[model samples]
Target: MSAGEFYYDQKVLENHLISLVPFNQDLHVSKLIHEVNTHDLLKYIPFPPFESEEEFIKNFWEPVLNAPGECLYAIIDKATAKESGESNAFAGTMALTSTSKENAVTEIGILIFPAFQRTHVATNAAGLLLQYTLDPPSAGGLGLRRVEWKCHSENAASRRAALRMGFEFEGIARWHRICPVGVSVEALEKRNGTKGEQRGRHTAIFSITWDEWDEKRPKIVALMERKY
Candidate 1:
C-alpha cells in the first residue's frame, strides 16, 4: 500500500473520554512503540515484543494497514493535555479488523496502554467503535450487521471486558489458534497443538448483531457515560 492510502471511510470517532482517529504510522509509531515496549502491552495478544521500531512497523503496522478492510485507530485521551504537552495523549489503540462486506461483519481489537488501562479509556473507546460500527445509515454509522470480539479462553479479563461491552458469549472453540509456548497463554486440555512447534489455545467468541444493537447500545453508552 502507498503511504497515503486508507481504506476505511470513517476516520475519526469521538466520545466524552476519547477520540479514535485513523492511525498514522509516521506520527504515532514513535510514541506507540515506546509505550508498547516499555509496558509490554502485547502479552495478552500473545505477540512477542518487537525487536526494533523498524521491526514493529514492518511486522505490525504494515500488515494491518495494507489489509483492505482493516484500520488501526489511535486512542487519544481527552484529559491531561498540558502534562503531555498536547491536546490528548496516545493512550492506546483500537482496531477494526477482519471485516467482511458480504457478511457485514467486523471485529474490534483493543490494547490500552498501562497508563490508561484501568480507567474509562477502554470502555469509552469500545463504546464509540460499537456505536459507529453497528448503527444504521439513518444513525450515521457503518450499518454493519455484526461485530465480533474474540480472545484466548484463558484470558478471563478480556472475556469479562467483552461481556461488559455487550458482546454475548458464543461458546469456546477448542484449539482454535496456535501460539508460542510462553506468551502469557495458559495451557488447557483442549489446547495441545505442537505440530507447528507452538502451543494452542481455546478461543472465546463473542458478538453483537444488528438485531440486538438497539438493546445493547444503550447499556454500553451508560457504561461509558458513568462517572468514575
Candidate 2:
C-alpha cells in the first residue's frame, strides 16, 4: 500500500542538492541494492543483513513500506548523478512513519548509504522534508503538528543528528522494545544486563513541534544553505 492519509498526496520533494522521491520497487530497488549490496552497512539497524533482493523485500520492503501511515522516499543526489551518468544520485533512503492525521503527527527515519554519510546529502535532504512536513497546507505543505525522531538511545550520533536538524531531545524510554539479538547494534544492554535471543532497546525520542517550528526553522535553513 502507498502512504496513509496522514501524508499528503504529494510524491516528490527537491532542492538544489537533493530530491526525495517516493520509493518505487521497480525503479529503485535495484539501485538501492547496488548502493548497499553488502549487509555490513546495515548492521546498525534492525533485521539481518540481507544478501539477496528476496530477503530485502521480505524483511524490509513489506514490513516498512506496506505499514499504515508509513511511506519511504529515496534520497537522490544530483551531484553524484552528474558524475556518474545515471539520471539521479541514489544516496540513501528516509521515511515518514507512525503518521497520525487526527493528531497531525509523523515520525521520520533515515539511512544514508555508506558513501554519502559524511557529506551534505543528509542535512539538505532532512531540511527539505522538515520544511515539507511542517509548513502549512496553504503553503503547499502538510501542516503537521509534530515530527518525531526516535532512535536507539545508545546511538549518540543519531541523537546529535536530530538535534542538528532542530529536533529537541525529549528523553529516553527504558527497555522500549524487544529486539532480536544482533539487531540492536547500538544497544548498551547487549553487553550489560540483557541476555538470550531477545535484547532490550532503550529508545531516545526527539521532536520538533509546530509551536517551535517558527524559531527552529530558520536555524535549520541556515545550516542547509551553508556552503559545503
Candidate 3:
C-alpha cells in the first residue's frame, strides 16, 4: 500500500460500508481511532488497555494512527441487519510489517463481539482483511508476500479460524506469550531495561504465502459460501 493510502488502498474502506446491512454509525470510517479505543468492545482480546479511554487514545492509538506497517478496521455485520446495537469498534486489526527487501508480511487477528462470535461476521470480516492484505497495490491492496495468523498455543478458536481461512501450520514459539498481566503494576517494581521480562503464555505461529493463497482462494471462497 502507498504511504498515504490506507492499507494499499486496493479496496476503498468506503466500498465495504455498502455491504454493511442497515448501516451502523459505529462502523463509520471516520471514527476508526475512537472505535479502537473503546475498551468495552476489545475485552475479548488479551491486549491490556490504559486507565481510561482518553489515556488509551493518547498513549496508544493516536501515536500509531498515521504509522505505516499497521492497519486496523472495524467489522460490520451485514447478515444481522440490525441497525441498533453496541458500536462496532475494531472487531479486529491487521498488521502488515515490512520484511526482507521490499516484501511485507501480514498478520491478522480478530475479536468478535460475544453475540457475533462463531457467526458469519467473523468469517466475512476476516475474509475481507485477508484479501485486502494479499491483493496487489495496483488492485488496491498491500501486495504482501506472506500473511500470518498467530495465537496463544491453546487458543483453539483462533487456531481453528486460521486453518479455516487457509493459513498453513507453522511451528510454535515456546513461552512466547503469557496470559494478560498488568503492565503498569509490573513497571513500577522493575528496573530499567527489564520491560521485556514481562511475558505472555506460549504462542503458535501459522502462515500462508501469496502463492499458497492463490492456490486456496477458489476452495476457500467455495467453503465460505457454503458456511456463511
- RMSD (Å) per prediction: 3.2, 3.3, 5.9
Where in model 1 is the C-alpha error above 4 Å? 1-7, 46-48, 180-196
State model 1's lDDT.
Answer: 0.79
lDDT of each: 0.79, 0.78, 0.55
Instruction: Indicate the TM-score of model 2.
Output: 0.86
Score residue 88 of candidate 2 by CA lDDT: 52
Q: List the residue pairs that clash in candidate 1.
A: none
Judged by TM-score relative to the true structure, which candidate is superior, 2 or 3?
Answer: 2
Backbone clash pairs for candidate 3 read: 1-8, 10-140, 10-141, 177-200, 177-201, 178-200, 178-201
TM-score result, candidate 3? 0.68
lDDT of 3 by residue, 107-198 (tens): 67665655566666666666666666776778766677888887777677788888888888888887564444321122312556655554
Which of candidates 2 and 3 reaches a greater lDDT? 2
The TM-scores of all predictions, comma-separated, are 0.88, 0.86, 0.68
| lDDT string, candidate 1, 1-228, tens digits | 222343457568996567898887766777877887777666557454575778876776676557777788888887854366443488888888888877889988998888888899999999999988899978878899999998888788899999999899999988777664335344554366434345566789999999999988888989999887
- Model 2 agreement with the true structure over 54-85: per-residue lDDT tens digits: 87788777776666688888898888987884
Q: Give me the candidate number with maximum lDDT.
A: 1
lDDT of 2 at 102: 82
Q: Per-residue lDDT for 57 in model 2?
A: 85
